[model samples]
Target: DAGITQSPRYKITETGRQVTLMCHQTWSHSYMFWYRQDLGHGLRLIYYSAAADITDKGEVPDGYVVSRSKTENFPLTLESATRSQTSVYFCASMGVAGDNEQFFGPGTRLTVL
Candidate 1:
């Protein structure tokens, strides 16, 4: 496949647990991003990676972390899951920031109890 894909389309976990969501892309895009969509908030960036071994924090990167060890894969980890973190996580990739369009994965719905 040439598009991006996310694993564990749905997940349920208790609060204070650690969970990792997987994201894979076949385009070998240079830019990978993690975002969470809540009810009212459209989309908030959690983390983004420019390339392999290069990662940066975004607007809402407090409880979430990301790594890009490979250009085609970027994984997001929740250090300590909370009820407030229960939201749909979306993974996206783009060739370049200003010159390319972003492609989003299906998304992973996480529920924290």
Candidate 2:
């Protein structure tokens, strides 16, 4: 797995339930990010981690949480899923911010009912 992989390529869940989307990369990149893509919103960041044990919130972190205890994995968890959260989730990674050319994983399409 030299590139990133996202699990549950498609998901359907009820509102108010907890769900987690997995991401894994083998490149050992320093920067990992989670973003949600919607019609008008292009792509909004949900969370990011610079390195193991170093995580931060991005533009749209509400209803979503992320952890990067390992360089190869960055999973996003939805504390309480909502209809508004239904969107395609993409995981990306780069070596650093300035020169980071993001490599995106095949997105996970989530539907909250």
lDDT of 2 by residue, 1-113 (tens): 66899998999999999999999999889999999999999999999999999999999998888888889999999999999999999999998756678899999999999
The reply for model 2, stretches above 4 Å from the true place, is none
Backbone clash tally (model 2): 0
TM-score, per-candidate, Cα-based: 0.95, 0.95
Q: What is the Å distance of residue 47 in model 2 from its true position?
A: 0.6
Tens digits of per-residue lDDT, candidate 1, 1-113, equal: 66999998999999999999999999888999999999999999999998899999999999888888789999999989999999999999999756788999999999999
- In terms of lDDT, the poorest run of 10 residues in model 1 is 94-103
RMSD, candidate 2, Å = 1.5
